[model samples]
Target: MRSRAGLVAVCGAMLAAAVALPLGGTAYAADTAGATDAARTAAADTPSALVLTLSPGESAQTVGVERAVTLTCTPSPGGSHPAPQEACAELSAADGDLAALPAQPQSFCAMIYAPVVVTVQGAWQGERVDYARSFPNECVMRAQGGPLYAF
Candidate 1:
């Protein structure tokens, strides 16, 4: 009975630590291209390091065209994302900073007001990541988000 009580206490402490980690974690945003060297290195050292949900959001349901996919980086970068390799490489280049992804501005876009909210929510190198943004329209979204949501 004494051993059993000790085991319960140890398990409880571990559970508490796990729950508190995210509250103290960093956003993993990059101030420089090299800022994520640690995370990138960690990812390379540990296979299958990134798993994120790339989405075009609820408005897709309204149009019956959902361009949502699960993307896995490292260990070959594969998932439902059409161009997983490119997407993963792009993400790695930005060091998991979704806002820092290079912009691929469209040549032109109709002045439309169809708002589209995009999101990338997942883990990067053991750190929590939650990102979301609203764009004026799909064209604008493509221009700003680049390949991350080009699916």
Candidate 2:
């Protein structure tokens, strides 16, 4: 039918435009990398913030280890952490479920008890997360918290 033929032509044109748009965008980006870097810097500086602390215990409030990192997960994740990409990947893998981060195998943990507290507070995937958990020791924290709280 003529209608079917016309529909195919329209679809073909739409597909071509869709393909061209991205190629055009790449060319535009190539042309504007210097100008865009400032904007990108500003965007990166925008806070997707998280604060992590490790303390001796829940009662002792002075932090033994602290890391304040800003994460940007959109358009590709990046931030100030030592392992930004890995941290983002781990968080993404957990779907922002901090509790879902797999614990290290029991075999890896030493039978030591020095009471360590781990705290995480910030926005993750646009939702605010405030979590504080005290583990038996540093080993326990590492065994349970994985890389997101490793720092």
Candidate 3:
């Protein structure tokens, strides 16, 4: 009877250890996964390229169609030279008239036109201005202009 009781006690301890070990490993894995997810979220929020904000003062006067606006690209997180960042602005009826009127002198704002591209030369750090030109056809204009702004 005594030997049987001792055997039962030993078996119970072995089972408990086996279960506890696996649970501890699972907890460690969960912690690692959580850390990885947080890191990814942080990276996504940071801007990888330089961005330009369009203001009413920057737009140029035009007639018949809208004008193409380009941002002066600066150094992204890692860049060396200044590059032209092209974006598009949609001109409303009011905007069109503003563009046409020589006396009134209409102004348009700037906005992001496309996803930023990275280059080997990268971007420069400083305040630079790029002019936005008017184009007749958007598709053709974008293709030919490479990067362009619309207003």
Candidate 4:
């Protein structure tokens, strides 16, 4: 009888511990919530940074072969991007997901197979981003990416 009672108490204690644990990380809600809030606040305060690179691999452009620029959305969208305001707005509208940016429907481009590769490297809203894509031409890139790639 004594052993059975001890076993039941131990099982109850274990169940209580499991219930109190937050995702099995911190042992309590208060601690986990505080840490999560601190991390979110830090991320928000830090200026979001991203580097945009465009390479005219097979494009017929003559003046600039390769171009790159730094973009910061937070702390007022300060960067070397040509259209920083528009770019930042578009990015925010898309929730930092570059691939989700909507493409313009009315925009038309030539069928030339001039491949222009573009890359975005860095962090967006504290989330690491490494995006790369090859557009058939610069026009398609602009039509699809909007002011974000207009730089």
Q: Which structure among the candidates has the greatest TM-score? A: 4
TM-score of each: 0.60, 0.57, 0.21, 0.69
For model 4, how does the per-residue alpha-carbon lDDT over 1-151 read when each residue is reduced to its tens digit?
9999999999999999888665766456666788999987887776788999888774324335388999998878878998888998999889788999989779999998877878898998789998887798999999999999898
Q: Rank the candidates by TM-score, best first.
A: 4, 1, 2, 3
User: Which structure is stronger by TM-score: 1 or 2?
Assistant: 1
Q: Give the alpha carbon lDDT tens digit for every residue of 1-151 in model 1.
A: 9999999999999999899877756543334447567656766655434333333444433443244677777667787777788887888888778888888744578998877777666766566777767777788777876666776
RMSD of each: 9.6, 11.0, 18.1, 7.5
Give the C-alpha lDDT of model 2: 0.71
> For all candidates, what are the clash counts?
0, 0, 12, 0
Model 2 residue runs over 4 Å out of place are 1-47, 59-76, 105-107
Alpha-carbon deviation at 61 in model 4, angstroms: 18
lDDT of each residue in 2-70, candidate 3, tens digit only: 999999999999999988988799788988898978875654443333232222222333122222222
Better of 1 and 2 by lDDT: 2
Shift of residue 33 alpha carbon in model 2, Å: 38
Q: Looking at model 2, which ten-residue stretch has the lowest summed lDDT?
A: 59-68
